[model samples]
Target: MNHKAWSIHFIYAGVILLLAGGQMYAVESYQLTPSATKFLAHNVGPGPETAQGAINHFMVNSNTGVRETITPPGWVAWAALSAGAVLSVHGGMLIANKR
Candidate 1:
């Protein structure tokens, strides 16, 4: 194939991603509130600042009742939306550049 063909593919994939990702993110966002609460409840101590540690903390706290008054990452939905938007724009740019 050629650059133009590849660019067209990118643009199409990006549009699909934007639409699907938006819907998925919206649905998932609603279900995340409880998970977020649990995340806050688990991440209270001086646990390792790593993804693995966070998972471990959540698992450990799930077995026990360790509640905390901290804020979890609330920008998850917005961040996902922004990523979809970025992909859309990047694909648009690729199409434009190829044309």
Candidate 2:
């Protein structure tokens, strides 16, 4: 793909990562609303393996709007935030060069 397209992708992905990192840092535990009917079934324990991304999380759904509760490590959250900022700035620079 072109550099412009990659830049745009980077910007979008960075923004999403920044948002996720901010949420992870802001709250100790947050609810993840599920759109799938399968998630409405049972609660998931924090075992070695559960779901793909939910491996390290504890997910419990008891007829509530909440789906998963994630408690990310401090370093992971900071790293994500830093990476997001870097990617976003890099994408902006790429776009500037394209002009």
Candidate 3:
């Protein structure tokens, strides 16, 4: 492969590696403290009672507290945007170099 092709490949690989590393670091550092989830449960309101009910249910039934995993709709949209950007860059490079 040519220098330009190698450069693009390296750049893409570097970005993917960086993202993966950051994600792994985040997961390793993440702590699920009760207060944070409690605050989310309170403000986002499936209602305080419902939130507490979930906590109680988990504690009683599973011997562990509830984990409220909230992913907003915009997250998926942003992921799609990122994927589009990568694909567009790849396509543009490929098409521009076609002989």
Candidate 4:
């Protein structure tokens, strides 16, 4: 592997890791806004595992006569997780292919 190729791989890996970390942090800190809740309810469709269902459940489960911290919808978190994983894998592949 040439030095330039190895350096490129390292840069790609670093960028991907940073993006993944930032995405995870954002997902962890995000709250379900009122508009977002409405949007989910309207667009997420049916079923217990659906986005709307997850949002509804999270809301109901979290606030039961007490103030509790709200979290992002399941689908949102899952989307972030999948995106991060894919990016990480691509970065890994870049490093692995460097030669």
Whole-model Cα lDDT per candidate? 0.61, 0.70, 0.55, 0.58
Task: Compute each candidate's TM-score over C-alphas.
Answer: 0.40, 0.60, 0.29, 0.34
For model 3, how does the per-residue alpha-carbon lDDT over 1-99 read when each residue is reduced to its tens digit? 765676566457646654754454344344456666655655554543676656654453453555655433444444644664575466456656764
Give the TM-score comparing model 2 with the true structure, all chains together: 0.60
Which 10 consecutive positions of candidate 2 have the poorest summed lDDT? Answer: 53-62
Candidate 2 Cα lDDT to native? 0.70
lDDT by residue for model 1 over 1-99, one digit each (tens)? 876677667667667766765665556333334456566545554465777667667665565544333332546546656776776677678778775
Worst 10 residues of 1 by lDDT: 65-74
**Which is the leading candidate under lDDT?**
2
lDDT over C-alpha atoms for residue 5 of model 1: 72
Weakest lDDT window of 10 consecutive positions for candidate 4? 60-69
| Candidate 1 local distance difference test against the native | 0.61
Largest TM-score belongs to which candidate? 2
Candidate 2 lDDT for residue 30: 53
